[model samples]
Target: MIAILSDIHGNLPALEAVIADARTAGATAFVNLGDSLSGPLWPAETADLLMREGWPAIAGNHERQVLTHAIERMGASDRFASERLSAAQLAWLAAQPPVLALTDEIFLCHGSPRSDLEHLLHTVEAAGIRQATEAEIAERLGDTPAALTLCGHTHLPRTVTLADGRTIANPGSVGLQAFHDDHPLPYIVENGDPLARYALVRGTGVELRAVAYDHLGAAAKAAREGRADWAAALRTGLAG
Candidate 1:
């Protein structure tokens, strides 16, 4: 079976927990959707783990940021400075391809097909989703028919069936969120404890799983790194 993951955003502990879960569930292959870097946690370490574990991954917006930085260092200054990526991290990110066609009928993207940074929310209309799907196909596969598109960016887990019968599966965020109230514990929380969102994809079926991990440990690390906002979000699974 294949384990699909995305939007990890450098939460090493959470990613480790998810990897353990996937292994326990017998996933032989792993497909990472994108956005593997850009957080308070170990970005380089996360990328190294994925590479060592042989997980196939696509490039996300953060990866683009790394590329842009490389261009800037080469005298092209149009890059986004907010990334603050290290040279080694930028090199690794630049090595990743923008898109990957997993099979004749399955595709993986960090965000929308049109743009790796675009957010394809579950609440979007069918027409919009269809348009995005077509744009993705044209840009990457060039008329190839894909039965399913797996993506993660909105951090909202969803399965949307389009009018043309195409399926879009969002496994949600492994390190962050795109939904949840301001409360301490929201809908998916277990007895007021926060959990990490994940998914396992086998054949045409996608099983969503939210596993609790060392939230306090992660939060403490984030705080120690002076990323208080990220630390708070880890504590509640609600992005500020």
Candidate 2:
């Protein structure tokens, strides 16, 4: 089985827990959908850990912003990550592609095939965040000849099967669980429980897994970094 992880956002405790869980589940390969080292907690340490493994990864919007844009061109979170990461870490982020065609049947991307910033499986309709229709997701995916596409950016566990039998899965976040974004749109995303999230995929089957961890410690780390918002999210998994 392959373990899929994303949006780690520098929380080392959560990442450690998720890795242990996936490993115990007999996952032999690890794929990290990026936005890995873009938070206040442990970007440097997390980067070092992941780099040692050299797991395959795709770049997320935060990774792109950190590598390609100046700190002045980034938002608060991106700026925070970029400012503290080592030069080698920045280079590693720069080396990742927006998409990875792992095999003829399997693919990996941070968000969508075309843009790492687009949510291929989600949309804001009315007042609620909803999963996109099969057609909508297929349209966003374009002509990628993949039966299973793995993506993460939303930090929500999701699985969508298109009419053509294409499956897309977001394993959720390994670190941060709840967050609010207001760049291209305004929305709040939450999981309501402080647990490390990851995914296991074998064949066409997908499992969204959550691993219990010491969330209070993660919250303390975020708080020490002066990110009270992140601290609250880490602790409660609720929107802060």
Candidate 3:
């Protein structure tokens, strides 16, 4: 099966838990849709882990930041906060491709095919979603043949079949849950907590799995990093 993940945002613990879960499920290969950096901690570490694990990952907006930082650093220009990342990390991020056409019928991107920063969530109105899907298909597929497009940026898990029969999938954030005040829980909670979220895509079927991990630990990490907003949201799963 294809193990798809995205929007990790540098949460090593959450990523580790997701990886462990995916491994247990016997996923032969992994496809990462990016946003691997920029979070409470471990941006460089997360990139390193993905490299060491030999997983193929596409570049996200954050990765573009890293690349821009490197260019600025080389030119002796002021770098953004993220540009302060380690040289090794910058190199690794720079090396990542913006998109991955995995096979003749599968395409992976950090966002929409039209833009690396686009948000392709299925929660939108059908007309809007259809418009976006058609535009993406035209740009990426272009009559090459039918292909499965996988993307992540909205941090919301979704699987949609457009009016023209094109398929799009977003596995959501492996480290952060989509904002929902009522849910008030990050994707994963501690053992048997039933809050962790993930998606499995094999062939024409997509299965979303919300398991439990250690919310307390994740929250503590956020707190330790002085990201009160994130920590609070971890409890409520609300972005703001």
lDDT of 1 at 206: 80
Residues 32-68 of candidate 2 have per-residue lDDT tens digits of: 9989988878888988999999999888988888887
Best model number under lDDT = 2
Global CA lDDT computed for model 2: 0.89
What root-mean-square deviation over C-alphas does model 1 reach?
7.0
* Per-residue accuracy of model 3 over 154-215 as CA lDDT, tens digit each: 67677777666767777777777633221212222111222555677788567776655676
TM-scores of all predicted structures: 0.77, 0.96, 0.77
How well is each residue in 1-240 modelled by candidate 1, as lDDT tens digits?
888888887778889998899899999888888778667777767767876776788887766765665654521111322244567656666777777788987887777676675555432342222234544433442343578788876677777665566677878778765233212223221112357777887777888888878988888977887777667778877555
**Strongest candidate by TM-score:** 2
Q: How far is candidate 2 from the true structure (C-alpha RMSD, Å)?
A: 1.2
Query: Per lDDT, what order, best first?
Result: 2, 1, 3
Q: Candidate 2: lDDT of 136?
A: 88
Question: Can you list the residue pairs that collide in candidate 1?
Answer: none
Residue 103 in candidate 3, Cα distance off native in Å: 0.5
- Which of candidates 1 and 2 reaches a greater lDDT? 2
